[model samples]
Target: MVNIIAVDDSALNGSSTGRIHFLLADFEFTGADALHNSRMTFFFSEEQSNSCNKRGVNPMEPACPRVMISGRVKKLDTTSPEYEDNMEAFNNRHKHFKIWVQAHHFYLNELEIENIFIVAYQGGPRTIDAEDYYNAQL
Candidate 1:
């Protein structure tokens, strides 16, 4: 499945159309000069690498499918009850996330706690984004 995550999408795209763009700037943090930050940082969890090992696959080795987070919000689509329930489960971690993001070392300031959503794929670590949410509390 192709997953898309739009960052401060308004910067890349003129409007809040919620479209995904995969350019270096869209994912990189150059410095403080750029006021535009998607903040939708992407990464393959340690578990992902372990699973790829079982399949005789090098997670980031050559020939592997591009590892990416690209997709629009699923809010518009009526997902199965199972999916809906799982997504709602994020509320449980809201407190912890809010705490960690505030801690000095690791910072993802662009995220709005109430607006986060998890995108699961390949039966592994789920991608996350706070943009393009439905009925967001933010």
Candidate 2:
């Protein structure tokens, strides 16, 4: 799985070396609305960054070994019957999955989210409004 995804230090550009730990944290899905387009709030301090830092990433830079990834699912814009059906199916699973991210030198920025899904699980929780996600101020 690691081979399929890219792990680099460019994602932690703004972050500096901080306390690092290895731990597991639960991330929930926010339906459509998000604060500053944040998928999830990563408590990196709770997780150990050593194991995932095989790239010898700078400790002074920000990096996370494991973090849950999420994003806003776009709604169907087409009117075709087939597309409508597909959209229905998509909505069923819209925000009910958990994607575990193993980032080496990545941040939550747009360019670095492509590899946040080394591992994923379906049927976790339904979508929630953005107002409910305010607590996760990532």
TM-score of each: 0.27, 0.21
Q: What lDDT would candidate 2 get against the real structure? A: 0.29
Per-candidate clash tally: 4, 10
Native-to-model Cα distance after best TM-score fit, residue 69 in candidate 1, in Å: 3.4
lDDT of 1 by residue, 57-111 (tens): 6655432333344222222122545333322233232334434323423222222
Local distance difference test, per candidate?
0.33, 0.29
Candidate 1 residue-wise lDDT at 17: 25
Error (Å) of candidate 1 at residue 103 is 6.6
Candidate 2 per-residue C-alpha lDDT over 1-138 given as tens digits, one digit per residue, 9 for 90 to 100: 011222112112333222111112123222222323533332222125464356565433434233433343223235645443332333233322113323321112221122223221233323444344433444
How much does each candidate deviate from the true structure in C-alpha RMSD?
14.2, 17.2
> Which pairs of residues collide in candidate 1?
3-70, 3-71, 4-70, 4-71
